[model samples]
Target: MSTTTYAVLVLIGILFFVAMDLGKRDKGNDVITLISDDDDQEEHS
Candidate 1:
């Protein structure tokens, strides 16, 4: 494979792993509460 192809493949692999990691973390309710709290504060301000 060419150098450019190899670099692209490596970049894609890194992104795939990062996405998988974020999926595994899966902070569902906490994220919702945090967002809601921020919105409430913004509205109050």
Candidate 2:
């Protein structure tokens, strides 16, 4: 196949996968979870 044809095919494949990925639904905010510990321990006299 010609280089142009190959390029077009690759581009279409990439676009198709991207579309499918975007169409997918995520369950929720499962991408990342933040846990912070702001409490500090101090010694009392």
Candidate 3:
């Protein structure tokens, strides 16, 4: 009903989403990963 209430609801929603995401990651259901290799990406002239 108020700004503070809305903010708290949003925070709770975000925390729940993050908790689910972490659970999925632990189960290896996520496919995204970071494999950056700057040296291998150098310009080949």
Better of 1 and 2 by lDDT: 1
lDDT of every model, 2 decimals: 0.89, 0.59, 0.70
Per-residue lDDT of candidate 3, residues 1-45 (tens digit): 699999999999999999988887795433333222443465442
Query: What is the descending TM-score order?
Result: 3, 1, 2
Candidate number achieving the greatest lDDT relative to the actual structure: 1
Best candidate according to TM-score: 3
Task: Mark the regions of model 3 whose C-alpha exceeds 4 Å error after superposition.
Answer: 28-45
Model 3 reaches what TM-score against the true structure? 0.56
Per-residue C-alpha lDDT of model 2 across residues 1-45, encoded as one tens digit per residue: 699999999999999988867655452233322111222222221
Which clashing pairs does model 1 show? none
- Please, what is the TM-score per model? 0.55, 0.52, 0.56
lDDT of 1: 0.89
Better of 2 and 3 by lDDT: 3
Model 2, residue 36: C-alpha shift (Å): 35
